[model samples]
Target: MTDRIRRLGMTAARFALSGALLWLLLSQTDASALMARAAAIDPRWLAAAFALTVVQVVLISWRWAVIMAGLDASIGTMRALRINLAAFFLGQALPTSIAGDAWRVLKIRSLGFGIGTGVRGVLIDRTTAMIGLVLVVLVTAPLLLARMPDPAMRWSVAAGLGLGAALLALALSADRLSGRWASGRLSGVAEFGRAVRGLLSRPVTAIPIVGVSVMVHLLAGATMWLIAGSLGLPVGLVDCLVLMPPIVLVAGMPLSIAGWGLREGAVVAVFALVGVPMDGALLMSVLLGLLLLLVSLPGGLVLAFPEPGPGQAAPRRIR
Candidate 1:
């Protein structure tokens, strides 16, 4: 009951934060202009962006399957797709982004895999995707840095880089650190770390996994470009490539519901650097969110009418 209360409190806090941020942003922007931008959206471009959003989820789900393969667990791409879609919906509906990840882990666990393997697969998948985003930001660092001459903005970028580097280091060295706990009560931790080391040790395996993640981010950028185009925003693909990663990185934070307020704020702030109006950027971000939700609607259906394979019973509890 205590844990449930704590979870409820956290959810309430996130809802409050999301509401406050949105209120602040919406108050500053011209409501009429925002509605005008929304009204002027090009259906053709919107459709294209929605299609790309579907592709992005498929690629991510495929990456999940590949990650499972590395862990010596094989849930074919189709199965991964089902799980990814359902989790995607859950991620959007739940309080935090981690909820989606938890759903993925739970689904995998339900497939009869040990809890340890399921956790490791999801962790590595998430870590590699983070590395991919970091690589994207670093690759375009020069352009991004040149555009932002403000010291504060520079420090924001620097802090982002520092955090990315730290995560990369921790992921690479987790196995070594797990050794100390090998004989301890935390056997699961040791096993997870060793699994990470083994999976990433092979160049052949590691390269493709990371590559897929990069592709996922790149595809997402393209989708964003299309979203901007739909709203007739001045932001270009190159601008999206250079700016969207940080926006994405920020939006990925679990601070708000489905990245609602954080994503809108990040979109407004980052695109403003490229001369996009705040209202336009906010509209584009909201449209992007709605379209993404629409694309994942199928997942809600999948979750509603789940099918289990013969001899495999779906676990009642997600732990």
Candidate 2:
């Protein structure tokens, strides 16, 4: 009961925050101009953007399959893709982004894997994605710093870099730490850390996993770029690449429903630094968010008509 109440309170708070942010941003902008720009978007570019979004999801699902394979779970890419699509639907429906992760872990457990394996598989997958985001930000660090002269923005990027480095350092040293916790209640955590260490020790397998992870974010940037093109915005792909990683990292914070207002505000703020109009940025962000939601709708079908369980008969239609 207490947990339920706490969740409700959090959900209410996020709703309030997202509403407030959207109201604040919308109030300051030219509503007519924003609507006009949105109306005038080129359908061809919009279609292309939606297609790229689908590719991003598939690539992410494949990355998860690779991670599970490393852990010897072997769910196969197609099954993982189904699970990921379902999770994406749930993730967007729920207030917190991490909700989908919990769903993924549960789905894996249902597939007859131990809870430990499920948890570790999802954790490593998330960590690799985070690492990819951080690397994208760092690789474009020079351009980012030059583009956004705000001290706070630079510091935020620096903090993110530091966090990523610390994570890598901890994973590299997990072998020594895992032994200490192997017999404790936290053995699961120790096992997870060891798994991270094991993956790092094998570059041949690790490289492709991380590389695919990077491509996922790159594809996301491309989606944003295509959105810009759809709306005839002045922003370029390189600008999207520089601006997206951090904003995406922020949107994944679970502060609002599917990053509704937070993402729009970030898009406006960051893209403003690049000389794009605020309305254009907000429109692009809104379109991208809606397209993402649209693309994940297939997961609803997956949920409604789930795959048959092992040793169970598949559902049949009546003539």
Candidate 3:
């Protein structure tokens, strides 16, 4: 009972913080202007953005299936899609960024998969996707720097790219280091390491997953581009490619509810570097968030009517 109360308290705190930040941002902007901009969005651009979002989800689901296969837990693509969408919906709708991932882990475990396998699959999938986002940011770092007139912002972006690169290297090396340690306290770490190594050892499986991750991010950038276009913001695809990754990385942080205030703030700051109007950028970001929420609504149906159990349709053996 105490634990339950503590959990509830933490949840309430998170919601309060998210609400505070969102209110703060909205208060600073012209609410009337923001709504007018939103009202003026071109339906065709929004349609394209929506279409790209669907493609992004499907591709990401396939990537998850690939990772599961690599880990010797073979889930079908269709099932993976359902689970992914459900998780996505939960993640967005819930107060925490990890709500959907936690749901995915539990759902997979319920399918008769081991807890370790379920946890490892989700962790590795997220790790690889983060690496991909970092790579996107790094690859376009020079372009981003060139666009920034302020030395401080340029240096900040460069430092972030360096940190991202260093973290990626560390993640890649962690698996190898885990093999040398045998402490029981580190057993979980060892298990994750082995899983990482197992996935990377098979490039045939690993490369495609990473490749798809890059594509997913690129598609995400495209979606943002369309959103910007809808808002009549003078932003280009390259700008979105450079800006979206960092905004995404920041928003993925566990601070705000579904990245509401954090994403808007980041978008406003990043777009300012390129001379885009803050109000328009904030509006575009809000639209993108709403579109994602709309796209994830199908997951509610999956949650209501879950797929059959493993006994009904046995999981395929990992090849």
Best lDDT among the predictions, by candidate number: 2
Q: Which wins on lDDT, candidate 2 or candidate 3?
A: 2
Question: Cα RMSD (Å) per model?
Answer: 4.1, 2.0, 4.4
Task: Kindly list the per-residue Cα lDDT of model 2 for residues 1-319, writing each as its tens digit.
Answer: 9999999999999999889989999999999999899889999999999999998888888888988888888899899999999999998887877878888998888888888789899999988887787778779888888896889888887886788779676754554673555657666566677787687578865887889888988888888999999999888899888888878977887888889999999999888988989889888888988998998899998888888766678878899
TM-score of 3: 0.91
Clashing pairs for model 1 are none
* CA lDDT of every candidate: 0.84, 0.85, 0.84
For candidate 3, write residues 17-63 as lDDT tens digits. 77887788788888788888878889899999999999999999998
lDDT by residue for model 1 over 1-319, one digit each (tens)?
9999999999999999899999999999999998888888899999999988888888888888988998888998999999989988988877877877888888888888987788889988887888788888888888888778698989888886988788677656555663555556665555665676676788867777888888888888898999999888778798888888988888888888888899999999988888999898888889888987898788899889887754867768767
TM-score of each: 0.92, 0.93, 0.91
> Candidate 2: lDDT over CA atoms?
0.85
Worst 10 residues of 1 by lDDT: 174-183
Error of 3 at 112 (Å): 2.2
